[model samples]
Target: MKRMVSASAAAVSMLLAGTTHAAVVPDYQLNSSWYSNAQNAISARSTSLSADSKAKNIIVFVGDGMGISTQTAARILQGQSQANNQGGEENYLSFEHFPHSGLAKTYNTNQQTPDSAGTMTAMMSGAKTKAGVIGVSDNVNRGDCDVSSERLVSALELAASQHKATGIISTARITHATPAATYAHVSERNWEASVPEECVGKVSDIAYQLIHQAADIDVIMGGGRRNFLPEEVTDPEGSTGRRSDGNNLIEDWQNFHRTGQYVWDSEGFNAIDTSSTSKVLGLFNSSHMEYEADRDDADEPSLSAMTEKAIDILLNDTHQQQQQGFFLMVESGRIDHAHHGGNAARALQDTIEYSNAVQAAIDKLDAAGELDDTLIIVTADHSHVFTMAGYPKRGNPILGLVVGVGSEQPSLAGDNKPYTTLGYANGPGAAASFDAGVRTDLSALDTKQLDFQQQALIPSGSETHAGEDVAVFARGPQAYLIQGAIEQNVIFHAINQAADLGGNAYVAEE
Candidate 1:
């Protein structure tokens, strides 16, 4: 057999040229053994993976900025959180065992690394748009709202037209880029509450579109209360509303859907009678919801709780004569925010919570006997610079210092100091600019703390989104589409093809 070198091993060789044993680094761990393991995994998938002939309900779980490295670290953390730290590497975060998965190239029409608006628009609208734009084609200039003719239709709109009951659940503001891409059309993603002074009257902000552009939502739950209320109405959080139009959209929502119930806290969210209520509207926090680690101080529901409620409500409609199944998007949105601050602990914790939410949805569907009838797709809008590096043994603590094979103590880096197992490429963790280059000594710090920020190579104002591809895991109808490297826009097409939402449903202009 040819002596084929894995790219990972090749990189290691290039980095350690002229050093003895450069030809082989046991710690690098990309040898024939790795090849065999990967091949075996693929063979297993071929035998066990099968898509449902039809999917009556579609659930898309978005873990924003959750790259492959993030997933690995989070999976290990989730496993370690268990009693006695049993089988960390083998611990499957809900979607790890998903039958079908593929890498999605997340580039936008104009940029290599994309913003949430463009990446999510690609997922929701079957067309890759420009960075900073949402639910509109590349023809529209950012911040210019007069592109009504260039506005792109979205998967949620197609679901609405198909008579499917739908829901949106997120840890982000309801009007944030990810959720807004599902329904709203705007040249700029930041137009969540108020349009630009120049674009006013010509364009509707994201919050406005959530109500006016898409009136058929069966469940709407997230934060961003400011965007829905009048300035005079102070929320329980002591913040004023952001709506400049003076419209109390919450009141409008109540009046418009007289049968729907509006709630702002966990108690109210928990009290909703999914069996009796025609619709549900929940706004947990004044802005973005608290991170899962900080949720103990408030009555805001967890991602899992909200997911169950949405699934139950969407399922309740299936008993109605007009029900055409459902489409639900659940986002573990806070992961992106945590990564922005270079807080690896919070980011991984959010990933775990997001996994719990996905498990909750699967459990709910299974209990309702809708498992086979529903399609669940777990993916990220794009990747962050999150990485798990250093040569840690299989059972070493994911958050602790890396321990090389056969070594009981943490290994020292080239700087002769211990480094963390997880780190960022560039973030607040970087002590100085890239030109200066500062490395922190993490040997004495508690890297497992929820507030801990991992080390980075380049000091940035904030960590940046990565240009690398993200993974998409799928089950149920049309899951076969997610078998190899794919364009991000294929997500919308796969769902549309499976649900029969009519071809080319995302074409801009009516």
Candidate 2:
């Protein structure tokens, strides 16, 4: 079959032949297998890639622990949710139909199986780091206090430094690893509220870093209200703050921007005038926000709502006056938390919510005429131990028990017990009540219940992350660079190249 050479590879070849291109990506990264192998794979797959183009605005959507299996299950669940729908397997999540798609090998420098801190760092900073560190290189120890020289610059910071608007939103605490990597640099991801007394003077905690260092961030939203408020102050929702430092970072945030609004509830969020708001900070929950399946009375904005509002606030900023564009990162963080609890129902629901957020960004940007110039990337930091099996007949409920293709009743195992269509490799669910060495019979239970935990093979407190490649989907501007199997860090390079962010693969502004 005839294959077209990738526009990026062709451009690189011609540029190399003509002039010496300046490279800002580290020499170690340029020499590593992760980087070189990704380049080769993209070049070999260029035949299916799109023409090279530069993007003015960039939006990245991260579905935490959303492995390929989770995506497939979520797509089917969504399809089945619609009226008069066929089997869910025929459905596609919003980003799945992007023109370019590939797999990203998600691993930290120290471990084969990755964690959010390391994986997100790779995507935001163009370099991989240790599993427990955020926005810093692997050269430093996991909990080391001093990281001045080891800190890495993220795409958001680079964009903001160039006078472009930047924003971050998540369903988890904003100080959590995934969202934190976009702005805060810390040796330990847990230093959200405060650090050890011995290390206090040497390094600031994540929340403190956000308020003091990343002052230019235009829109900030998600949970972790406790991290920002003082211990003596209780939020309107009755949750007490956790900050030992007695620092009201929310007040500090307001002091930084005279026109910025700090909102903690749905009423405040809905009242914000995105058209005139210079900046906004929203902390809907004291911890991570409620899972989508349980968010009805939570008084918090949905992931889709947060995403749409963040885009609007960024678009309205006059500081982005030069047309330098903006960079926004949206994370569906609770998907990982739900998977860790072995609850596939909640996980799938949150994944669907995440897909809606992606669609929301696309719709909003397209309506604003920014879609064509915006490079939107949808991907996951890593995979969970979740699995889907059984040859169930078509039109079966995704959350239902495993009923075989030809049977009217649930399928039985060799041990004479019924099972669900979804299960985990290892998790708390593995300890399901046992009766005389036989597994618990799930036939009498409602497997589709929101609180139901899927059965697992090995007993564990929580399901672990899988050491496999996750899917990456892209559309608009330099998206062709996403083709073929690539390293996770390649995401940062793609964004840099597409936006001319002065990286090794940087494309000169036309």
Candidate 3:
């Protein structure tokens, strides 16, 4: 009898412990006062509101290659430079205004200088992998059938499983690397145009899977219409020089269209009825949409305009009460393109446009009283090699040569010293020649020199990406999780923890 009683007591204790663990809430605490206030606001709401508010909506804004220096350069070019004598500082971008901010280290397992495919795969799936790998683990050999269940699930996929609406907006082709990381899986990132033969009958192409498999992605904007259309029907210029499946995908989409609405240009996009629509497909260019600076009024919709339209249509679902919300991913993808091409003017313009989109989202959410309940995260996937130096007069134009150092300085004697405005650490276009005619003044030169001089090395004229930590800014609940330096994949865990979402889908168990 004594032995039986002891066994019963042990069982009872185990039951009690299990019950207690089940009742415990996940850890979603904030480390900063600002985030604490936001958390208080979230908890104080009525039970019904709070219940629906458990991350009902998530909006992630990715500045493709716009790192800290990119933001500073954009601000300077926009006349909001910190050097300006204006008394009041320039207003923060919508994302910048977020109360919590953190930094993320971007590097792939295989490469120091990472590509968008690997970085975004980590961002979307929470798993770190090699440079060219996407949607799957680097541990899995490229074409091996015996790949591990180590596959990571995207936040969008998780939200879809919970009956939430999901949307992907970008300035690049819908099938581009960053956006594709959210839905498609493959060993290679360039597989956008190539659909596996096995996937043909079993699963649609990645593009089709994104539109069909999940919760009928409500809003699909940006370019890559050619990928959807068959070769015969494709516009000459729209063919991305890549072919897939030998079938026009655009026709397939149209045939599969149920309540879907399609818009090819800005005019058609503007004509859509956001209040009554549930599904929208707007592909403005045959490839990626034109850059914001180069896009004609008739051809493409502005990033801000597209963002507003997406929000309007997403909110149309009767299911999204103040408590139940949606999930949106907006990408300012062209900044990376501009940097790759080494066009400073074009890159800065796109950055400004991206900032405008952030402001637009803030205005819409604030007006609807949803800002406090919503968590806004803004960050870049990686850093670029761009740098600014060259001290000119107090009011000198940022584009001009540096005033106080280098052989280009006017005040410096022959072969003495001068200065330049721009610099790069590893760029092919660093300054190597000491041209006397391009000299400037060098009176107040700083002791430390710039990262690189103009026309110094390879002369390719384009800056490259650096292996450095990039900044992450946040506002709303759990903003404090973004403090100090952290690995890039930590972002996924921080966001999941703050939203009270469970599971370590990406991390390996010790």
Candidate 4:
């Protein structure tokens, strides 16, 4: 009986020891096997390419809805034709010249093609989530999600926690989906400018949460001044929109007068002393700033200008010297809106503008000797259903109709045609008729076509999101981590690992 009792005690002790050991060690070991395989494959492709040390600053450029096809289409429209005989020029979108390039699958759990909220949330937090969801997971209660411990820390928050200065610049409203995902938490992505009646008098709006919760927002630029102002402030159209709160949020921002500077126009933005100002709030337009093509002034800063200004201010912080680095997120968010409106001209122009912003970052960082120290990553949150198909003549206008050649073209049964101008799966301006024989003037068509055989899917109107993978171009430290196909959330992890931001607490261990 004594020997049996001793045996039982030994078993219990062993079991407890095993449980303690498991608790001490992380269950999910760092699986370098995949990384090692990728490294080997990379070595086989190029001997010159090698990973660099840790980056000092990280600049992420997200072209809101600029998918891979969008990039390809933009390249072609920007004079890089994809023809065999014609001399096609290679016009790099600044970051494309980077030593590393990769593809990222942009899909949320709920949808194959995700909205900016879910996609950006993944990029910012390094966690997969449902479509239309922003910041927090679907499991968390909506109102408490932001302050919940289960909520994942954003890359911006992580950088701030490490003492780095952070900034978010966008061409859309500062409270728009992409930018909002980085700082604000809500059940829906569209909650940025939204004010629920339940919390109207008691709690702050998402816009307020964005500015107030952000511990180190050195630069805040873009539109959505309507949300910031009281009902009294006349909008750009000279009318007062709905205001849930009697308190003017813009005035609230100004109350922090000594610590911040607010600019209402381009001239004001340029006049501000970035050297002296630690915090800047620039609202150039009442809503989204004018389209890049529509802008008249050469002196007026574009999205690129705002990005440069943000970087300048963030890097100037003297306190937390060790955290002297800056993490800036710049977004060309209007691309998606333009696509939704079925404005090819506007969409492509926005793409070019986005590329220009990327170029500006490259030039500024290069000039400041920060290019090598900065990990500049350029990508899109998701893609639109925008496509370019049909065999047009070499150097043909991308905005023009698709013409088919005789003999080589597919047979058209009784006036049924084989070519189309442009198409969408389901958008507002989709091709109205299925019969190609109905020769509608291509010049009058709103959206472009994908050129698939049989019936072409039309978009509801101007916009549609694509479920395709987006391109990621990277430069500087650990850029190699961005090679090959990867999940959208992996981008945050790669950035975190490259910057040594530490573990992803959101990812559960198997």
Top lDDT: which candidate number? Answer: 2
Q: What is the lDDT of candidate 2?
A: 0.84
lDDT of candidate 3 at residue 413, scale 0 to 100: 33
For every model shown, what is its TM-score relative to the native structure?
0.87, 0.91, 0.77, 0.80
Q: Give the TM-score of candidate 2.
A: 0.91
Stretches > 4 Å off in candidate 3: 1-53, 80-91, 142-150, 195-205, 212-215, 236-241, 318-323, 393-395, 404-420, 426-456, 459-463, 501-510
Candidate 4 local lDDT, 285-361, one digit each (tens): 66787777677554346887887787667766442354558888999988887777656666677788888788888
Per-candidate Cα lDDT values, in order, are: 0.79, 0.84, 0.63, 0.66
Which model, 1 or 4, shows the larger TM-score? 1
Model 3 residue 352 distance off true place after TM-score fit, in angstroms: 1.0
Instruction: Arrange candidates by TM-score, descending.
Output: 2, 1, 4, 3
> Candidate 4 clash total?
19
- Please identify model 2 stretches exceeding 4 Å from their true place: 1-51, 317-323, 433-436, 505-510
lDDT of 3 by residue, 344-420 (tens): 55677798899889889888887777777667788888878777764454434444455653334343335566544
Each prediction's RMSD to truth: 14.0, 6.3, 9.8, 9.2
**Cα distance off (Å), candidate 4, residue 423:** 3.2
Q: 1-510, model 1: which lDDT tens digit per residue?
A: 123334344534432322221222122222223223333333344356664476688999999889888898899988887887655887889988799899988998789998899999878867777999987777778878586556555677667667778889999999999998887778988888888788887878888878865536889999999999888889887889988889888888898888789999977887899887868889988899999988962589999999998888887854356778888999889999999999988888999999999999889999999988888999999999888888899888888888999999889988788888888889888863223454567777787787787888877889999999999999987677677877787787677656766433222233
Return the top candidate by TM-score: 2
Return the TM-score for candidate 1, rounded to 2 decimals. 0.87
- Clash number by candidate, in order: 0, 2, 31, 19
